[model samples]
Target: MSPANPFTRRKDRIDELAATAASPSGGIAEAGAVDEKPGVSLIASAWSRLKRSPVFLLGAGITLVFVVLALVSPLIAPHDPAAGLLLDQVRPQSNPVPGPQDGFPLGADSRGRDLLSRLLVGSQQTLIVGVFATITGLAGGLSLGILAGAFGGWVDALVMRVVDVMLSIPSLLLAFSIAAVAARPSQVTVIIAVAAVQVPVFARLLRGSMLAQRSSDHVVAARALGVTERAIVFRHMLPNSLAPVIVQSTLVLAVSIIDAAALSFLGLGNPNDRQPEWGQMLGRAQTYIYDYPHLAIYPALCIIVVALGFTLMGESLREALDPKSRR
Candidate 1:
């Protein structure tokens, strides 16, 4: 111990540094652990962003309220939506439409049905029309998009040409033409008319998205790996191309509802007042609009609010899914 060996002291110092670095709380180890953590998926990341966004929350809230009302309207409706219980209160020459009364909170429509109850019940029809029409359109568009995207060349040209023709026409006018062909006005006809208008929209959107993704690194890699064309198109291209389509669906729901209402307003919808619908109610209200603006106001307000909710939800979703928004 007269003179401590320099080599041994150096060795001890080296061992001490190694132990410190190997400890659980060491800076290097901690950083390594973080680096090893799995990354969040696109869907999960988008969902998280949506949760924190005020616009998403507001849209979700409004959409939820309408969905709930649609589901529970029959159980909660204060009166038979089809019954003209306030018939006595409504007079053609005098009180065409009754104002808010004791039982009728929002007043009665021109037909003497409880406005509040009809509105509550009407939610079901409006939602049905929008959802069914969107689904139908999505299905038709997916078929055409898949064919075009997977085949390109003449197939793509043919499909796109048809889509172009559809898009060239004004959407409402197209709906009107389709609806006018039906033998009689019915809910089915209205759904078909609305769906036809949306098909080209979804087709164009999906086709464009697929075309963009076709030349991406992933597609090239898949093709190089000898992946089947079908698998590449459906498994890779189709799935990857769905983001914009999904966002468009939400916006389309709003559009479908509005178009259905327009069809109804133009007398292309069901003539039976027995089955109350928001659009049908709105259509009737137009007759007494000037004299009793409330008749038109209530249903009109409902359409705007519900459509606005979907639009907000769609816009928020678009922003959330945008790569530019990623931190």
Candidate 2:
């Protein structure tokens, strides 16, 4: 105590300061902890960015509403979608769209079916066509892309030439021709038709993406290491090349929805008035369009809104994934 050890005192002070700095409120520790946190993956980062984007929000919101509407239609819808006035279930007489007094807020069709109910139930079909068409196209396209991209040489050229030939024709026309020839007009026919339209687009996109990825350092390394070509292409290249294809698939959903609707409107979809398909609804509406424009407007508006939602989502995803497009 006579002369406090200067070094000991200094050491005590340092220890005390270090304890404080290591406490819950230490600024340096907080900063260091943050720095030590794991970095986000490209997909996670893209998702985070997409969540922050108003465009993504809008698109997702619209699509979600339709999805919800479709899923819970039986509960939320005002009336049985198939409930019609005529003996044949065709509302050929109820062209007089009624008020809510009859439980039809959105009005009635020529078959006297609740327009609102039909519209609500129609969401299911619309989504079905869109989803199924997307799946069909993606399956076919992925196969072709992988085959062509992995094989190269004549296989690539052959596949690409076929794709090119298909691409040369208008997508809708090709779909229409296929639908007309292969099957009877219905949801299945329409689905196949729309999927056929999308096949070339997906095939080309995935093929290009795979080709680009093939030249990447990782791919080359795998090749150098004697990895099987199948393993390299399927395991390594395919996964990396999927980003663009995924983005394109989103955009394609919008196109598929629109195309499905077009086919229905053109009489290639379900013709039964009882079947509530947006496109079919539009087709049936043509009969009473002059008397009740709402008939045409409702289905058209639904198609437009749903398609817009997918389009927005696709575009937003594309921009989020592409660093060059980020603001």
Note each model's CA RMSD in angstroms: 4.2, 6.5
Best by lDDT: 1
C-alpha RMSD in Å of predicted model 1 compared with the true structure = 4.2
Model 1 TM-score relative to the real fold: 0.87
Error of 2 at 45 (Å): 1.6
lDDT of model 1 at residue 83? Answer: 92
lDDT computed for candidate 1: 0.91
Off by over 4 Å in 2: 1-37, 85-102
Per-model CA lDDT versus the true structure: 0.91, 0.85
Q: What RMSD does model 2 have?
A: 6.5
* Candidate 2 global TM-score: 0.85
